[model samples]
Target: MKKLLMFVCLSGFAGFPSTAVAAPVVVGLADGLAGNRFPWSTTGGMRWQQVFSAAELTGFVGQNLDQIAYQTVQGATGYTISSLVISVSTSNNAPGSLSSIFANNIGSDNTVVFNQANVTVGANSSSGGFDFALPFTTPFLYTGGDLLIDVLAGGSSSAATFFRANGSAVTTERVYSSQGSPGDAGGTATSNGTLVTQLNFTAAGAPELHPGGAVLPLTFAALSCLIFSRRRRISY
Candidate 1:
């Protein structure tokens, strides 16, 4: 009987059959994000349509979303992605796919290469809408700087309807007509119109901070406490 008691007590000190503890730490999250559509200040019929661009990003300060809010808690950048409303004012113009929306990494050649996941578009001038949270094939990080969202016309026109980029030194450049070559393919509109948007990035989360990770150190601490208690009892 005494030997069995010793074994039981030894097991407890060995940190086996651990006790489950309640977790009470609640962390806040970032605001949900949605793309905003703004009308160009100028609207008129010209030989080549003039691309309207969003104003230079005046603020890195973020706006609020009703459905979901984006926040930074415990160093992790929280994202609340959802559907967004959009609109295009041109006669036959419309909002296209977001597949092209990606992280443009500056290359060694001093150019940009956008890397991201495939995307789809279904919104129109009448009732603009978009679905966010499509799985990202190439999720890029925005350390800081300009980010452009270009709307391209499918082989339909040599000119682009619009093009927009957001970040510091925000400037809206609209080209009503194509300067020359057909320009790159895809949804990026050469002259459709572009809007300048603004954004700021928070630090990304580290692997160690994930949940279920606090156990290791906590277990060690608990084991130490138990050993101390056993030693005191033995001394007595």
Candidate 2:
């Protein structure tokens, strides 16, 4: 019993069982060529939805989804979004299959992660990098499976944001509107294109503070161990 107690105490001290804070993690296609931009202000389009298969987003299972990041192409230096709403959800579909109907392709947990005005997106010096981001207002708890990204914006930029593409793997699908300020659900489905994008997530129930935050993990671990040792000594 005493040995077991010590083991348990030490485990806490050593940050066992994944209780430590989960660092912000990103998952997506590696850097690649320009794909396309959203609500291209130049054409007056308003909304878009990017779909990614469960195979691509499997890493997000059991995590709290927080941010959706975009990359800019080499041609344009900056992209400005006047009013934007970013939403995300999940689905259960094969990597190569997608329906032209937006409603036919999503789960019920669609969440508006970001809604802001007048946001400026910066450019990547090279082909494209995950530099533009919309920090979610509330982290979406991803239960696992396919992921969907819905974007609606009321702004414009001369340059475009590109995504990494895999012509061989049709794991991503997209839908967007060509008219200005289309309703959230109004958009024409386009040919399949795997977008190179980045998504960030936070682990749920993490007890440790961020690196510089007030309480350190070791502090609690040491205190717990000390208390346990003292109790054992008294019983003896």
Candidate 3:
């Protein structure tokens, strides 16, 4: 009877799934200077429509933009991750097109990479790149806040000028063809034109999803049965 019972238990172990076999999935959230809300959508292959200007983005650094708007993994267990990459793109236009990037710790009042990069637009065809590696001590975990990008300035001497916030400069230079006429500079070559840009957040590796309390309870019940059966044979 003891040998028979042992055989049954070992068979059950073979049937059960191993906890070590599951892989995790990761999710990330991104925010702009403006309060467009969390879980911002991505469309047009890689273009994001909800870009924020510099002034609209000032108070949000080092805080979770999720308090306003954020994104999440569809189904995943919260766990420590290896690293996260945040990307910022500046306009690739000629002049007045630049994107300045910044980051701050969530909850604490410190700059991660304050004004980290001032990108040129036309250098990358309406876009540039900014990536940050998670600091070893920080581990880069999101609370309902933190992680965001802002547009500090934008415009062109030959293009329309617009400020994301206060203290921005916009020049009215007509350089279509260097014509003396104000509106008819169509023949002049434009100068100092600035284009708008975007920011994004991505994570590396997989995240584990919580199986929920119900599944755990069922697993416990089965484990208990196995233990009880083994005890009965040993007692005899």
**Largest TM-score belongs to which candidate?**
2
- Model 2: what TM-score? 0.69
The predictions' CA RMSDs to the true structure, in order, are: 15.5, 5.6, 16.9
lDDT of each: 0.26, 0.63, 0.26
Q: Encode model 2's per-residue lDDT on 134-193: one tens digit a residue.
A: 778877888877787877777565535544443333556666666565565545664444
- The candidates, ranked best first by TM-score, are 2, 1, 3
| lDDT score at residue 201, model 2, on the 0-100 scale | 71
What would you estimate as the lDDT of candidate 2? 0.63
Ranking by lDDT: 2, 3, 1
lDDT of 1 by residue, 1-236 (tens): 44565666566556533332211111110121222221111121111111222222223213111111111111112221121221112111212212221212112222212222222222222322111112222222322223232222222111122212222111322222232222323223232233222222222332213466667866776677568667767877
In model 2, residue pairs whose N, Cα or C atoms come closer than 3 Å (at least 3 residues apart or on different chains), thus clashing, are 35-162, 35-163, 164-196
Candidate 3 residue-wise lDDT, 110-185, digit = tens: 2233222222212111221211112122222232222222212211121211211111223211112121221221
What does the lDDT read for residue 68 in candidate 1? 11
Error of 1 at 235 (Å): 3.1
